[model samples]
Structure formats: C-alpha cells, structure tokens
Target: MPARTSRMTLGRLLGLSRENNRARDWFFEDSGNLLPHHRHHELNPSIPPLEVTKIALRLRHLIEECVPCELEESLITQAHSRVITREVVLAAKEAGGEEYRSCVVFALLVCSRWFKRQAHLELWDATLHNVRSTACEVIAKAIIEGEEDMSYLLHTVLLHRFSILVNGKPTPPANAVEKAVDLHALRVICSSGYQKCLQYLWRGWLVQDEDDPTVFVDYRGRDDQRYIVHLDPDRLRAPVYQNIARLLFSFIYLALYTMSINSVNPNGEFDAAEILLFLFTLGFICDEFTKFWKAGYHILSFWSAFNGVLYAVLTVSFVCRMIGLSYPIGHELRHSYDSLSYNFLAFAAPMFWIRLLLYLDSFRFFGAMLVVLKVMMKESIIFFALLAVMVVGFLQAFIGLDLAEDLKTDEIWFIIQAMANSVMQSPEFDGFEKFAPPFGILLYYVFTFIVMVILLNILIALYGSAYSDIYENADDEYMALFAQKTMEFVRAPDENVYIAPFNLVEIGVIVLFSWWLPKRQYEFVNDVVMAILYSPLLLIAAYFESRKAGEIRRNRSRGEDDDDTVEEWEQIEDQIDFEAEGWTKRCAAVKANVETDPAVIEVRKLMDEVAELKLMIAELKKGMDGANGKKKDDVKKGSEGDGEDS
Candidate 1:
C-alpha cells in the first residue's frame, strides 16, 4: 500500500495519445491483462471459451453440411443453424459494446465463408442481415446519443483488424487488410441505405479532436469540444443541408453557363450573362484549386479528373473571349478568337451534364450504378492497354508496306481511317489491297479479326465481370461511394465554406485581411461572414433541425423510445410498393395482428392441445401392446412347462 495505483478506464485509455499504438491494442484485445477490468465488467458476460468454440464448430459444420437431394434434412439443418445464430445474437444484444462487436465480426466472417462455400442456402441471407442490422443499431444509437465518438467505432471497432495469437505472437488472418468489420459494416449500411448510420458517418466527418486531427475526440469539458462548426449550432451547418444548397447553386451556375455560351455575340464585348458565368467559373476554379491543395494526389479520382477537364476547357474559352474583346469589333482576329471561345465552351456541355450525376449519386439507383460504371471503366484499362500495343504494331506494318510500295503519304490517313472504322464495326476493306498487295489486304483482315473478334470480346468479358461483381454487392459498393463522397466534402475543411461564385467574394474581400490578422481573429471573421452570406440556407437548415428536435421531444414526453429514424426508414421501404394491397403491407398487417387475433390465438391453443393429446395416445398404445406381448410369451412358457410335466 506504499503507492496507490489509479485504474485505467475505457475513457482514459481512449484519451491516451493516439500515436501510442499499444493503447489501441490494449483496448481491442480480448485476452487477459489487456482489457480494463471495469470496462470488461460493464460488458455482458460472454460464454466460456470452450463453449464458444463448440458453438462455432457446430455452426461451421451446419454451413458445410450439404443435403442436396433431401429437402427435409436441408430444412432441419437450416432451422437448427438459425436457432443457434439467434441465440448468439440475443446474447450479443444483452452484452453490448465489445461483446456485441465480437459477435458481429464473427457472424460476418462466417457469412463470407458460407457465401464462398455454399451460397445456395437462401435462409442464411436473412439471418446475416439481422446480425448486421443489430450492429448498425448499436453504432447508430451510440453516435446519436453522443455517448461515443465515431472515431472509436471506425478505427477501433469496425476497421480494426483482428489477429490470431499464434505461439504468443499476433499473426494476421488471411486477406486481413480487405476483410475487416468496417468493410462488412459499410456494405451492410450502404445496402440497407439506412439514414441513421449515414447520419452518424457524415456527422463524424465534421468532428475535430485536439490530440489527433484525423480522429474525433470527446472532451471531458463539453463546452470545449472541437468540431469544424462547433462555434455555430449544427442546425445551421448540417452537411446534408449544406450539400443540398451547393447542388442548387451548381444547377443555377450550369443554367447561367448554358445561356452565356449559347447566346455568344461574336465581335461584341462580353454581356452581363457572360460576365456572371466567368465569375462562377472562377469561383469553381478556386474551389477545385483548394481541394487540389488539400487532397493532393487524391484529387486524381474519376470525378475530380472530369472536373479538371471541364475547368481547363472553361479557362481556355474564357481566355479566348478576353483576347477577342481586346481586338476591335468586326475584325478577322476578333471573330476567330470569339468563334474558338464559343466552340470550346459548347464542347464542355457533355461534361457539365455528366457531372450532374455526381450530385445525384446519393440516390441508391444512381449511386449503385455509378459504382458499377467506375468498376467497368477500371476494367476497360486492360482492354485499352492491349489495344494500344496491337494498334501500334499494325500501324507500323501499314506504314512500312506503304513505304515499300512508294504509296502517297496522304494514303496513310486513309489507312488510319479504315482501321478506326473496322473497330467501330464499319470496316473499310475496299482500299487495303491498293496499299502494297496481297500482304496489305491479308494484314488488314487479320487486324480486323484481332480487333473486332478477339480484343472486343475480351473487353466485353472484362466489362461483364466488373459489372457483375459490383451489382452483386451493389449496396456495399454504393455505401463505399457514399462514404467517399462524404469524406470529399469534409476531408479538406475550409475555416469558412464559400460555395461557388460566393467564394469569389470571400477571396476578393475576406482573404485580403486574413494575412495580417491573428489566427483566432481570422477564423472569427470567416465564421461571421459565412453566417451572414449563408443566412438563407441556414434558415432552411434550422427548419429541418427544429422539426427533428420537436419529434424527439414529443417522443420523450410520451415515454416512447426514440426510434423515429428506424420507423421512418421502415415506412419509406414500405412505400416502395406503391400498390395499396402490396405484399409488404399484407405481411406487416398479418404480423402485427397474428398474436392478438382471437381466432389465430384459439387455433394455436387447439393445435398445442391436439399435439399433447397425440403424444398421450401414442404412449397408451405402446403400453397396451407391451402388456399383450408379455401375456402371449407367459402363456407359451406355461404350456411348455405343462408338456414337460406330462
């Protein structure tokens, strides 16, 4: 008792410096001396290690056991498996926190294994979904209640890679990098399109901790909690509302650009519309530049690459327009530059429309489809790589043949056109023989076969594979995309967000004083300016947040659980079947009243009584049969004794 030791709590461990990797390990490990005693006590007691092993082995056996021709055996196996899973899930629910997380991780691992081994077990799909749903609820509730930080869930629970203790050393599982709780959870959350989980994710993005800027930190002093928008009410700066406001602004900008480009006045000075378009484009350029500065190499993503191309064209067009204005009206040079400007601007129209898809990707249909498209595009790289090599080889052959035959250099363009046409399914085979001789025509035919038959088919196969992979796991892919988009917005936090053309004002006005001002003063100035500039959008945000607040209040007053989000999601899911007499509605109605219905209740009781009566009758019949057999055996033995006596 010479020195008293303070106990390590979960909160204290979490508060430890994130750079100390051992702290994270200690927090997550299940073994002795690793976990804090108090935290472990808070968790529901788990089944003994031996029992858990036995249960796991049983589950594995059930998953692997195949009874293809026997339907009854298969059904029995499935029912038994389901009962075991439900029991485990129930235990997990009772034991929350790490216990619940461990159960979910095990379930997902098992599901993956089962999917690989026996995907024909359709009954498992619902059981797996239930496990995921429970996991989602745990994280969602924790985040919604502000009881735990998102960083803890993401890094420690979900994204945390588990290792086996092999000979007193940590050994990583196979494909440990990709197969993690986070990936499974993300896929589940994304597939379900659950709003509560999404809210937790995006909200966590805004959280900033003093110890580690990358992770969210919960402060002991509530007032000192750090968030990007901590100085303001969340109602006024919600990410959802902010993104919606930005989308609306983008549509307006697009409309302005369309009008300006279409109504270009050659040989005349820029009009009001053109001037506004320039400002908006400038604002977008600034936004992209900032993102580039912050995201660096990460800005090389598909969407960002598209943005880069669009901005580059717009910049060139704007420069051309400016140069045209420098020249006198009706001048040849002026008209030439003006023509180039309009043409370039018009060329970007396809990109502008395609970029709109990025905003709409939050919708499940679009989001999932975008994931498919991205994957397909990635797969096309292999086709393009092969095509490039083939094209170069064929091009050289044609050029060499032309040179040998002393054909006009102008004929080279025709050969190029023919090769392209063949690839496009419009083979121009008419003039290939004229280039050199039989060799030229023969080569052309070979090239066509390679391009149209072999290469194209290979490309198609690749595309199909990529498409199937994404579509089969559409929910998870979409969730990953959604998570990516959410991060894109929050990854580079601007001390003050200035959306588009409005950003131009911030740069021209607010930034002028930023260099000379103190850090706090600069931040304060930016916040105040943004609050004023975004007041209208803030009002909209306030309305939505207030309504949500009111709902929570009403729920609490009525002593009802705050499960409004779940209820809303369920309702929305039901609404997907627009027909009044839809299967979902029918199922819900029947389920709700099944237990309460008098007729069904009576019938269930009668069935139970009939089953008991059947058991009694079978026992009585068995007893009477045994008595009759014994009497026959005794009579036979007595007759044998009488014969012996005679």
Candidate 2:
C-alpha cells in the first residue's frame, strides 16, 4: 500500500488512535506555534502507537489548513525524506487552480523557512533552491498579470535569496528565480498594460532620504513616511525667463526688418512676395530667439519694446498702402522736410533700424537708445553720400552741356558730364533719392561728393567695428564674413548676380579703416582735450569733498573719544568719593586714578600733537621692540645664537 493509505489504515484499526487524534487536534489547533520545529517535534518519540497516530493526525491537519493542496501534501512528505525539488513545485503550480497554486507557493515559503533550522546541509540546500526558483517563477507570472503590488510579494519571497546568491556565492544559478523576477519587471515596464506600475517604481521605489542616508522605506500604502524627488527652483526659472525674452526679441527684429523694406513707397500696394518672406523670416527668427531665450539671456526686453514701435509703423504703413494713400508727412512738403531735417531724427522716426539697434544693446537702456540713433544716422549718411555724388555728377553734366553748346568753346565739358553721370549711375548710388533734398539742383553734386567721401566711409567703418566687437572668436570671424556676404547678397539689385568687385573694394576700405583704427587712441585724445579744458575744476571739487569727508570722520572720532574719557573720569571720581566714605576700599584705587588720569591726559595731548617728533619716537620704539624680540629669540636659540653673535 501507499504510505498515506498505510497511515490511515493504522489510525482506523487502533482504539488508542482516538487519544492520539485528540493530541494531534491540540497540536494543529493554533497557528501561533504551528510553524516552529520544536513545537511540532517536542512529543516523546518512544510513545504508544495511539500517541504516534495522534501526532500523525495533528501533522496532517496542520498541513491541510496551511498548505491547502495535494501538491503541498506531497511536498511536506517529500520534504521529510529530502526528495522535493523545484521541478515538483513547478509541476504542482501547473496542475493546480489559481488559489491552490498560491497556497502551494505559500507552503513552499513556510517549508523553506522551517528548513533553515535543520542541521542537514543537503536538505537545507535543496529546500532553499527549490523554494527560490518556484517563488521567482510565481512572482514573474504575477507581474505579467499586471499586478501593481507584486513588488512587496517579490521581496518577501525571492529578493532575499537572490541577494544572498549575488552577495555570498560566485556561481549563482544561470536561470535563477531572482533573474526571472527582474525579467518580469522589465517586461512589464515595456508593456502598455503596466505603465502605471513602471511609473510607481520610478517615482516611489527609488526615492532617496534627506536625513537618514542608509535607511530605505519599502513601498506601503500606509503613512510610512518617505522622501520625494524635487527640482531646483533657480534651475527651472532660468530657462523659462530666457525663452520669453528671446521670443520677444525675435518678433521685434522681424517686424523692424519687414517694415523698413516695405516703407519705401507709402502709396504702393503691399508686396505679397515681401509679406510672405517677412512671415517666413519671422518664423525663423522666432525659432532662433526661442533657442537664445532658453539659454537664459535678458536682452529680449529691449527688442520687445523696439519691435512694438516697428510693428505699429508697419501696421500703419500697410494700412495706408492697402488704401492707396500716402503716409501723411505733413500738410506741406516744406513742413515734412523740416520735420525730417536731422538725419538722427529721420532714422528714429522710421523706428525699424532704431529698434533693432536698441534690441541688440538690451542690457543698457540709454546705451541702446544711443546705439540706435548712431546706427540709423550712420546708415542714412552712407545713402546720402551716394545721393550727393549722383547729384554732383548730374550738375557737372548739365554745366558741361551748357558750356559745350552756349560757349561754343572746344572744352572737354561733355567728358566731364559723362564722368559725372557715370558716377551718379554707379550701383553704389541705388537708394539715394529716398531722402528729399532742399536746394535740389544746385547743391546736389556738392552734397553727393561729401556723402560719398565722408558719410559713407564713416558708416562702413562703424559696421566693421561693430562686427569685430560682436564676433571675437575664430568661428565668429567666419560668421561675420558670412553675415557680410549675406548683407551684400540682400543689397544687390538682382538676387542672381554677385556683388561687383568695385563694391567689394569699397567695403574692404571701410572695414579696414573701422577695424584697424585705434578707437582707444581717439577716445584718449578726446578725453585729454576735455581734461585740459575742465580737469582743474573737477580736481577742486574732488578736493573739497574729500576734505569735508575727512573733517566729518575726524570730528566723529574726537567726539567719541572725548565722551569715553569724560565717562571714565566721572566713574573714577564717583569711585574715589565712595572709597573715601568707606575705609574698606583700597588706597590703590586713588593711586590708579592718579596714574590712569595722567596717562589719559598724555594720550589726549599726544593725539593733539601732529608733529614729526611723535612719529620719530614711535618709529624708534617699534625698532627697539623688534630688536628686543630678536634678542629674546636669539637667547632661546642658545649655541646657534652665540655662534651668530661671534
């Protein structure tokens, strides 16, 4: 017969088995002491057959209550004989229902914990390996089932065994139960079904403590107080503010660049091509500005303010153009000319270039405003110079024609006229007629010559200096060249054609003068001239201020010392009067008063004396003190000092 059947038959046949069954009932009744080996095995092994039957019945009852399945029954019997294996547990899991499988798994955990008490090495090793493997597989399945709270179950079963294998042994099983649990967690993280599980693990599981460095709080729904991850506020704020500024600046630049291009003809229809280009360019600028803003620059505010005005002008100009109306200069042309007389005023009124310059110098409000005015005037000056040259050439031609026809002289007046016209018609003179001239015909040539030679040259130089300052690195040098080329491309009448060699030559001259000239020298020259004119007055004022400050400090120190001395004297007098009234007071107090009072008077007198004698005495005393210290140090050095002295 099978071992289980034999045991049952034995129990049924004996009357004494009834008493054994009662003892077994007592043994298996409570869960409190059921797990420990001592409680289960404490009964005498040499007892009657009735007692043995009773123990067997008690063991069977405990197994039924705790283990809950046929597999656990087989495991408990096999465990006693050291025959149970991981494969047997797995087979049980495969055969049983979900509840049975859970029960079997739990029974294996209890058995493994019980086996830890056994001295038999082989039994212990086999039980530990089997339990760990089975636990790993079961936990992996639980994880796959999309269970959110499997981590705790995993830790309770296989995590400890896995950690032991990792820490204590070198050759842990290749297909260990711990690895299966990890694989399951990884699979869950990758799956859409367990996204919340993965998030919980990421946010909650890996949190570090602020106070206790070594302690880790396990995941539990209860108030098991734990640390949380926090982002640095300053780090978060920097990028946000930077991006805002960048966006504002970019918008402003786009508005200004577009408006300036469009405002050439007030009554003309808005160019669809330019408008599209403007939008596209604005988009690109916005993208670049976003990058700059994200990097944490504060220059965007100036650009924003500038762009606001430029956008307003553009809106008004676009409205006027769409309505087939000119932007109102004034009631009369003369008044309009008068209003736009100063080159600085004209550039500032347009708003585009002025705003761009201001945006570029965002850190300094006043400085940015000045830069805008300067840049606007500089660009205007270049155009005016070109215009002046054209006018001069036109006049020379007219004069040449008149002389050739009216004088009836063999003058090369026609050649002069041709030369003047050639100069006027040069590509450099493209935008000269935009600014209306007052004494049109007569002053045109003279003005043109001055504009070309002086104003244009100055503008070129200014641009070169600005570019050099902005781009200090070798890479920046390349970028500066690229920017210059781009500007040339934009300025060219036909997009297809390259800038002419003559224009390049002119630009080169401007760049050379602007960049190579010693700016500091010029500044120094101006400073020297100003110093020569007003430095004496500045020196006088500075001297007066310094003297006043010194006097105030002196008076303060004197007053403080005087008050302290008066207080000291009053205290000494009160102490003396008290002492005279009481014989218990020391006569040394009176002596101290006399000595301290004289010394104090002497110190005050010394302070009042600002003569060289006190300084000499102080110097002599310092020297003597230093000498005495050196002698004392020498005496301490004994033999070395004596040798040095000899």
Candidate 3:
C-alpha cells in the first residue's frame, strides 16, 4: 500500500496463531432520529431555545459510536425539507428523484436556524478539533505505516472549505450547511476508524499482504483495531489461481443477478442462483467484520481504497435485498438500498473491464502507448488543476454578481452549461450581458481569450512534448513497463499457492486422508500437491525471480551500493552526455577543470580506456554491417541467375 510497503512483525503473527483475547467486532448500530421532530417556527415557538453546545456534543458522540455508512437506505426521521448538502444533491441525480434525499435535507434544515452565528462558528471549530483529537487518539495508540489516515482529515477540510474562507472576508452564506455536512461526514468517518481500517485491509490484500505477497485473504477477526492489534506478516497466502477463480465466480453471480428474466419466474420467488449469490455476499460481509476487530491502523493504495467503497456498496445492496425484497420491509427502503449499489456498480463495472488494459500494456506496441499516456496524464494534472481553480473563481464571481437571475442557480449545472456555451461562442449570451453590468461583458471576453485560446494551446503543447519524449525511447518505455509487471508476478511465496476449482482435490485429500498424519505434515502435503497441480505458475515465478536476483547482483558489483548511488547504466549515460550543461563553453570548462585536477587523473585514464573500447565496438559493428550487405547482394544475384536459368 502506498508506494512504500510494510511488513508484518513477528509479535503480530504470534497473536494471530495464538487465538486468545479475541475482541468484539464494532458494527453499525443505527441512531433512530437524524433531526428534531419539531421546528422552531415563531408563530407558537413551541421548541426550546436552540442549544448549540448540547447538539454538537451529542452529534459528536453519535458519530463516534456509529459506522460512517448507510446501513438502511433512509434516516428514521420523516420530514420534508430543502436540499442542504452536495451528497444529497448527487444522490438525487443518480436516483432521478428528490424523494431519495429527504433524510439528509431535513437534518440540515434542523441545523439551518443557527448555522451562521458567532456561537455556532465557535462550536463548529471546536467540533472539528474534537474530531481530529478523537482520530489522533486512535492513531497514537496503533502502529502506523504509510501516511496516517487521520492526516487526510485536515487535508479534506482544507481542500473543500479552507480556500473559500481564506481568500476574501466575504459575508458567510446563510445556508452554509454544505460545509457543515462535510465536516460532520469527516468526523463520523475518522471516529468510526473507517480510513485506518480500509488502509490495513488494502495493505493486506493488494500488496501481497503482510504474510505473503501473492495471496489475497479473508479473516474471521480483524488485526488492525487499536484494542486488538495483530499485524501478522506470515499468514499463509492462498494461491493466485484460486483468487482468480473466486473473482470469476463473483462475475457469474453478478451476471445472474442482473440479466436473469423475471417474467417467467413469479414475483418475489427464490431461486438457486439468487441463493448462491446471497450466501457469497453474506460471507463477504462476515469477513468484513473481522477487520473491525482490529480496525484503527492503515497503509493503503488507490485500488484498495476503491475496494473499500465497493464493499460498502455491496453490503448496502445485499442488506436491502434480504430485508425489502425477500422479507416484509416497506417498498421505499428496499428499492433505495437496492438502487444504492446498482448505481455504483454502473460506474464500477466498467472499471474492471478497463483494468485489462494494464495487462495489455505488457505487450510491446501497447505498452509503449500506455506508457506514453501515463506520462501525458501525469504532466497534465497540474495544468488542469490550475484551470479548474480559475473556472471556479470566475464562476463564483459571476454568481455573486447574480448575472443570470432567470437561469438555474445550481452551481454544478451552471458550470456544465457555461463550458459548453463558451465553446459554442455563447449562443445565449447577448441579452444576459445586460443582467449584470461590467462583469458580464468582461466574462465573455475572458472566456474567449483565456479558456479558448491560451489554456487550450498550452495543453496541446504539453501533449506534443510528452509524445515526442516517449516516442523517442519507445522500446525502453515498453521494456520498463514489461519489467515492472514481471516483478509483480515473480516474487510470490512458495507455500499454500493452489490452482483452485481443481484444488478441490487438495481439500478433499485433506478431509479424507489427513487425519492419519501429523498436522504439520498434513498441511505440507496438501500444499505440495496443490503446488504440483499448478507447477507451470511455480516455474514462471522461479524463472523471473532468479533473473531479477541476478540483475541486482550484477548492478551491485559495479559499486552501486545500497547508499546514495545511481544504476551503472545511468552512470554511463551521464558520462556520455555532452549537452546537459547546454553550451559548448560550459562543457569545455567542466572538462578542463576535470582534466587539470590531480585527483581526477586516474579517473580520466579509465575514461580514456572506456572511450577506446567504445570506438572499437563501433568499428566492429561497421565491419559486421558491411559483411551483411555483401551477403544480401550475393543472395540477390544468385536468385536472379536462377530465374535466368529457368
């Protein structure tokens, strides 16, 4: 996880095997009401005085207690209210209806009355500090690897809210519930140990885990929790083929769930396929519970982070299907939760298909293109980020001016329409220019000159330069990508790696015959048989591992020590480069300084020998080429003579 990996400590492995002091797994226990039942409207004003302190304190405690995910589709409270947060708005978009967002909207309405006062601001700041403190408490208690998950708390806060407040001391909006909700979400996530938990799981899953590099595992009790920390580095990694088979089975289940015809079957009827998928999902959920047993330490990567998201989505859907579809739950609850994961899978399913591209990148031609694309994307990120910031600034300025009173006020939709209209020469802009004076015409010109001309050209130039650089060394790019993937496939563990589906033979062997032998021998024999069944993979892994080791040995022999050192190949390239200093005079001055120094005389003698050897190599290559040309000519002449004879 992260680019830097963590290994498991021996103490943690002992804990996993010892099986003592097993802790209770933390889970999502619902808070019944999200918002107040009664409103503080002034006609009767029946509600008590708004006690911000009590509300903040209570909310913090609830967040700390609960998991930061939607176990049930809707909140317990039933109330109608205006939209207050971006999350609810996005959900509405996905659902194609506003009814799905009622709970969150209503909760924000309850906080709306006191959202902008000095007392509330102070309370809000105190709550954030409390959130971080709560997170820090868990972090301090656990052994950490990668960047601390709680470190993201300050970052997400700064990224979303900090910029707006820092720039100009503008009047804070009355409906600042957006920022409030984000903070609340962050608090819940951090306090729930979600981030750390995900990190730990990812470190175990994606990066060969703590015990073995090639195996993916599921545990009955989690080892990342603060109270139950067990960082096992030597947990037996199951075979890669077994994991592949498992993933394929998951796909089969997904296909059955989505594509099976319902008309032929009766409504709410149970089927064998459905039962199997339910069993698998239930097992996945149970496996997730173990991570919570020790759930407050992490080291994560992008893939693992997304895997956590998929886990949440799948659980939401699975629970909803079990309760609403299978049992007697209400229609809305079932439908919403069912849709929750379906909507996410709509986006995520394609991602799996696209990842096959990475495998394709091992091919020479495709690898060059992928490597080039990777280069371009990395270079373009900062440029695009800058453009995004400028767009946000201008768009906010235009909104503050209230230029388009007739059009929609939604910031997201406005940005989309404006980008499209700007590119199309603003077909609807003429009359709107009169809505807000000076700023309106100014917006049109700035859009034309900057967004249309300057930024677009700069982006083009960046792509052109990146393409040239990559294409110039296309072969090297291909080899590097190929080599990187080879290392990933090579350095796998020697034990317990099975060829699944067929490895049923190994499991059957264990069950029928294993009772006679010692437990250790039984395990060893089963593992050996499984490995023998998948001998091809073992041979491949061994071959690459040996090659990689030999390469390292050769590199080390050239004095590329573990300390500050460059590769031998890179050192030779650097010595050959005459234009790194730009002008001929700079190169000359450097050479002269080196030549005159007594300390460099011995090195200069070695340099001369290298040059002489390079020249000799060139002469040999030229002679070989001349001989090859003569052979080609002779072959051509012989073919012509044969034709004449015929």
Clashes of each: 1, 9, 8
Give the better candidate number (1 or 3) by lDDT.
Answer: 1
Q: Which stretches of candidate 1 lie over 4 Å from their true place?
A: 1-195, 201-237, 407-409, 464-476, 490-492, 559-646
Compose the digit string of candidate 2's lDDT tens values, residues 1-646: 0001011111222233546755653553332121122211112111232332233233233333433322332343332222233443334344324412223322333333333333145563554434333333333333334333343332222222211122344323211122322232222222232332222222233111223211222222111111110111111112222223344544554564556454543334335544553444444444334435543453344445455454444444444343432334433543333333222223434564454443243233434344444445555666566656665666555455455555743434533453455444433233223212233233444545655566556666767765455333323233222222222211111201101211233234445554656754433332333333333333443344334334433443454310123445565654565555675465555544432346677887788685667888999999999999999887889978788999
What stretches of model 2 exceed 4 Å from their correct place?
A: 1-236, 239-241, 244-305, 314-442, 469-646
* lDDT leaderboard ranking: 1, 3, 2
Q: What is every candidate's alpha-carbon RMSD to the true fold?
A: 12.6, 44.2, 30.3
Worst ten in a row by lDDT for model 1 = 1-10
Which structure is stronger by lDDT: 1 or 2?
A: 1
Ten consecutive residues with minimal summed lDDT in candidate 3?
39-48
For residues 273-377, write the lDDT of model 3, one tens digit per residue. 555545555554443343333233332333345446655655564565555465344456655654553554354455444434544564578788888888888
Task: Tell me the lDDT of model 1 at 224.
Answer: 17
* TM of each candidate vs. truth: 0.62, 0.18, 0.36
Task: Determine the C-alpha RMSD for candidate 1 after optimal superposition of all C-alphas.
Answer: 12.6
Q: Against the true structure, candidate 1 has what lDDT?
A: 0.58
lDDT of 1 by residue, 541-566 (tens): 54444455445445545544333444
lDDT of each: 0.58, 0.36, 0.42
